[model samples]
Target: MAGRQRWMTVVCVVGVGMLTTAGCDGTAEPAAAPTSAATRSVTPPVPRDLFSPRPEVVRTPQEACGGTPFRAGAVRAYTPDGPRYDGPGPHPVKLLRMESDLLGMGPELPYQWTGPRPAQLVVCEYEDETFDSRQVGTCEYLGGTVLGATARVQSARFVYRVFEARTGTLVRQFTLRGNTTPEETCPETTYAKTALYDQQVESKDLVAKIRPLVERDR
Candidate 1:
C-alpha cells in the first residue's frame, strides 16, 4: 500500500511538473526585430542651380531680316559664344520681332513646359518650367554645346533647349528669364501645354506676320 501511494505521488509530481512547464511556455512571448536607420532619418527637396544639356542662345538665327524672320543665330546653330546683332555679322538673320503690336504678351499666358512632375503624366511634366522669377539661373557652364542671342544692347538667354529626342534636331526652346521657365526635367513633357499667351505667343504672332518675308519658294 505504501509503495502504491509513493507511485501515485511520483505520477502527480510528474503531471504537475509537466503542467507547470506548459503554462510557463504558454506565457512566454517573442521579441520583435529592430528597425532600420532610415526610419529615423528623413530629408526634403530644395531648389538649386545645376548644369543642363540643352542648347542656349541670346538671339534667334532667322531674325526679322526683313531675312528669315526667325534668325537661327549662333545660338540656333548651336555654336555662338555671344549674342547676334543685325547688319553685317557672321549670322545674317537678326531681330526676333520688329512689329510694335506684340508688347502685351504677359496678359494672356501661353502654356509652356515646366519640370519635376507634379500630378499626372502630362500635367506633372510642366511643373517648374515657368520663368516667373525674373532672375538669371540655368545650366550655363555645361561643356557640351551652347547658343546665345544679343540685340543692340540687351541679350536673351534660354535655360532649356528643345530638341527632337529621336533625331537631335533643334525644335522649340524656353528661357529662364521671363515668366515662361520650364518646370519638370522629363523628356516626355514635350507635348504638354502646346502654347501659352505670353511672349511665346507674341513670338509666334511675329513669325506668322512675317511669314511672307522669309517663307521661301518651297
Candidate 2:
C-alpha cells in the first residue's frame, strides 16, 4: 500500500489459493555471531501482529447480499480498475477480475483452466479478510549493530461470490474461510539478500482450517 516498501517477494499469480513462490533478490551481512552473555540474551526483533481485528459478528451470504447475489455481466469493463483475464479456455465465462494490493508482486503463472467452461461463466471474487504488512529495524549490538526485518500476513474471506457471465446472475455463493496466511517471508537477518523463510508456524493452523474448502474447489 505504501509505495512499494523494500524487498517484496515476486509471486506467481495463477488462481485464488493457487499461489507459489518464485525467486528473490537482496542482501544482508551475516548476523554477527553472539559472543557474549548479553548478546545471547538479546532476542531478535519480531513484528507486531499485522492484522487488524474484524467485527465479532459474522453474516451469512444470504444476509449480506439480501438473499440474492451481486452479479456483473462483464469484468473487462472493470479491467482498468483491476487486472482482467479473458476466458483462458473455451467456456463462455467472458472474463475474470482480480483486485489486490499485491498485484505488483509479479507476472501471472502459466495455468490451464481444466473443466467444462461452464455454460455460464462464474466470476469468483476473493475478498481479503486479513492483510497485514509490518516491518522493524534495529541496532543489535547495544545500539551498535543495524538490522532490518519485515513480515506479512494475509487471509481471505470465506464467503466468495460466483456470478453468471452473460446474464449477470448470481449463483453458487458459499462461505468457507480458508488459506489464512498459508505462506510468508521475511527479510534475511544478517544480509538483506538472505531471503530467509521466517514463516510463523502458528499461521499454519489457519491454513488447515481453510484446506477443506480449497480441496473442495480442486
Alpha carbon lDDT of each predicted model: 0.26, 0.33
Encode model 2's per-residue lDDT on 1-218: one tens digit a residue.
Answer: 45757775565533444554532233332333334675455755655545564433322323323332333333222112221223232323321323321332211211222233232333343443453423222222122325433333333333345543333345455544333232322222334412322122233343343333222421
lDDT of 1 by residue, 46-118 (tens): 4343334455432232221112223234222322333222222121122323221233222121222112211
lDDT for 148 in candidate 2 is: 36
Number of backbone clashes in candidate 2:
11
Residue 212 of model 2: what lDDT? 39
lDDT of residue 215 for candidate 1:
29
Best by lDDT: 2
Q: Each prediction's Cα RMSD?
A: 24.7, 31.0
Candidate 1, residue 142: the lDDT equals: 21
